[model samples]
Target: MAILFSRRKITAWCVAALASLAACGAFVPAHAENLDAPLVLVVGYAPGGSTDRMARLIAERLSPKLGVPVTVENRPGEGGRLAAKQIKRAPAGENVLMLGNPAVMVVAPLVFKDLGYDPDKDFVPVSQVSSYDFALAVGNKLQLDRAMFLVGRLWAHPEEAVFGVPATGSLPHFFGLMVGDALSVQPQIKGYGGSAPLAADLSGGSLPIAIDTMDSLYAQHVAGKIRILAVSGKKRASFAPNVPTFREAGMKIDADGWNTFFAPSTMPQPKVQLLATKIREVMQDPGLQKAADALYITPVVSTAAETAQMLKAYRQQWEPVVRRSGFAP
Candidate 1:
């Protein structure tokens, strides 16, 4: 026999049925209750870059620790803003995260007036993964030998002292301007799409001075195609201890480039903590450390709290420098 019920009765019946299912452990909410979902580590730059390389390494180790599949996705645009915006708009429980650096997290806010996301408001720092320093290098094609002498030439002929950077509004570009300010000379700034071309020109002697990260220039320096004038850090880099720091060279400049993990701010605290812990654990592995060393990167395993403090301090330190550079994107 068929039975028919009123609308209210049908509604109550459905509610009772759902409650029974809940009691029987058969009901699952739309939001995933487990961390079994696939995790994606988004890289702002395309494949073959340092960030992409590091992301893949972390993903390989992180997958085992989390007991879930981990993959790297390259978004590659707008100086990492594209990937950053994608992470910002991802679903809360999707397990999407971004590997961020100063270009996207620190400098974007100051340079891009219409940046799609705010580093402070849209994201949470998970952990700091790696760090490296920048270096002021002169191409073998140039007729100069020392950074001090270069400064003197800039003062003597500012028009001929242009510097090349990977991109406009990048840390290297700002640092180039800072160098000019310290020496009280104005030189033209050349922006490239990536370091490869800048490096090629620098090596070919068309571009005399190139300011770039140590890793980007280290190979050329090793090949005897470029001379690293001075690195920017308190102490000399381990890989290039012979290269004096900018401070030791009489320029009181200290800047270090770093990479950190970030999750959407909407993620739950427990999940955030779990991700942070897992990343820190993976970064501490000896094998990972060896790989980072080979890549000329220092693996820094910092807690979420420490990561947050580091970002805050970094922003504070660079804010004045960015302002002084008078750059806007």
Candidate 2:
């Protein structure tokens, strides 16, 4: 009777302990437990820009899946450098991440002599959300549709090769350089505040030529305000299949850019993986895919290792190009 009583007591104790743990959420699923805190998605661009829009889209879909609130914070300045610097200094426990692009991720550090942040040491690539290609667009004053015609006009009148880019020393700026190099014409590049003003100038015919993301110029191109001549892709972009790629147009320039979520390197590997997995799942949602298509970006699902490798390859590919350009911001 004593032995049976002892066995009963032990069994009762185990059940009680498990019940207590369950109440305390000790045995709850890891994802749920780990994500007790809400996520703050940071965008380093102004409201309504592509990066901000993307951040909002991801956060909206991610909130339901993680069962936690997700918010997008805009810290727009210096083409995302300011926001990146803030993220670099964020505490490991903070559930804050930045949607970064090549302007700050790739081109800024490469060109800025006094850049304050070190991406390689301070930021870990969580996952790439989407990729986009740049396009060389011209104003209606040019009335040219093909690349060869534009090249001929620019070559014959070298002064007319002036080009506008979103920012100086950015990927689009360098892509413009690549275009100039390919056509044996030295383009005089101008840096605008952002795509809005650049597009405005292009539409008004103040800017003879410009290089920026395909999406930035698509609406104007569709409205017949401006004409996109060539995109910096290996093949034609789906959104504008009628427009030729630089390669298809017989130019040797091929470049693309992506927006990726980057977290502080101090974040634990498991946490990063969990967040990455959730993000990829959100990106795979059909609604998200349709939204991305409407925004002129291709949804991407890549592991952290792959994102890191992509950045590594990007650095390698751009090192020589940067050195050759000798551009100083």
RMSD of each: 6.7, 4.6
lDDT of 2 at 222: 90
lDDT values for all models: 0.85, 0.85
Q: Please, what are the lDDT tens digits per residue for candidate 1 over residues 1-329?
A: 99878999999999999888655445534443346578989999889888899998899999878778999999998778998888888766578889999988988788788898989889999999998888899987666767887777777788877889998888888878777777787868899987899999999989999998899999889889999998887788776778888888888778888999999987766678788888999999999989987887878989999999998899888888887777888
Task: Quote the lDDT for 217 in model 1.
Answer: 94
Q: Which pairs clash in the backbone of model 2?
A: none
Tell me how many clashing residue pairs each candidate has: 0, 0
lDDT of 2 by residue, 215-264 (tens): 89998999999999898877777667898888888787788889999998
Question: Which residues of candidate 1, in runs, are more than 4 Å off?
Answer: 1-34
State the displacement of the C-alpha of residue 28, model 1, in Å, after optimal TM-score superposition. 15
lDDT assessment of candidate 1: 0.85
